[model samples]
Target: QQQVKQSPQSLIVQKGGISIINCAYENTAFDYFPWYQQFPGKGPALLIAIRPDVSEKKEGRFTISFNKSAKQFSLHIMDSQPGDSATYFCAASQQTSNYQLIWGAGTKLIIKP
Candidate 1:
């Protein structure tokens, strides 16, 4: 329940397309969910997040949809761009943990021109 596991390792999307990836967790105690975006060797930056209180959250081109009962969540990118090509990670943590993050293995996204 403490780990968020992602899949596909990598994804390729054409410009202006949509990208989607899934994640699941075993720990129901986790309440905070966040998605991060990283470019190259840069540190992951928080892209968007949703808590158990909300079913979804969106920021600009990035969106995170959550399912509390299912213990799953997903990240969706709309209008994929070359600049948006980067690694994405999903994370989980409890507020009581002081927001310490449990990260998913990074997913490399490539937006082909």
Candidate 2:
């Protein structure tokens, strides 16, 4: 889908806890999925992604669980740390397209001490 909608607009988790964020899309043509993590004064970097072809993808403490039939996906942060607190964005796009990402409104994650 062309639109990726994310929720909880903001999240607060204690250090060493698990943080979860969810997203949904309307279009199924979108073939590429990526999550970007952004910190203050810095550009978002590709955190991790999963295509419709895969059910889940994980990178270290970050995991992306996707549901193609439901047109939804979620990000799970394990052992969240204060340093992990940042704005996370869920994105989707078609590989055939020019790589224009349809982004979520942005979820601000804050880990409390």
Candidate 3:
């Protein structure tokens, strides 16, 4: 079984600051990396992500980057706000795995005003 390891079990960011979360995968077979954000009382929502082929992706205040050589990917929340406080997860998926995502442990992020 493949595994995705994430760093920073928890994080604190000031409002308007950038929040970064990282994930590393063992198997190169993994092709896609997606970032998800979960609120205190809501299910996870797809934040941003992309295939490793692109190397990087950016949407609004969020960005996802892939490093093929390092077998790693990361999520960056730009100008993070208080509303951005949530639990973040990094997941890797492969077509061969029936699109089942192997998830990282998760990071709890808090944004201060």
Rank ordering of all candidates by lDDT, starting from the highest: 2, 3, 1
Candidate 1 global TM-score = 0.93
Candidate 1: which pairs clash? 1-26, 1-27
Q: List, residue by residue over 5-111, the lDDT tens digit for candidate 3.
A: 99999999999999999999998888889999999989999988799789889999899988999998999999999989999999999999899999999999999
lDDT of 1 at 6: 93
Candidate 3: give the clashing pairs.
none
Tens digits of per-residue lDDT for model 1 on 26-51?
98889888888999988988888888
**Residue ranges of candidate 2 with Cα displaced over 4 Å:** none
> Model 2, 1-113: lDDT tens per residue?
37789997999999999999999999888988899999999999999988899999999999999999999999999999999999999999986678789999999999998
Over all chains combined, what TM-score does candidate 3 have? Answer: 0.97
Under the 3 Å rule for N, CA and C atoms, how many clashes does model 3 have? 0
lDDT of each: 0.89, 0.93, 0.93
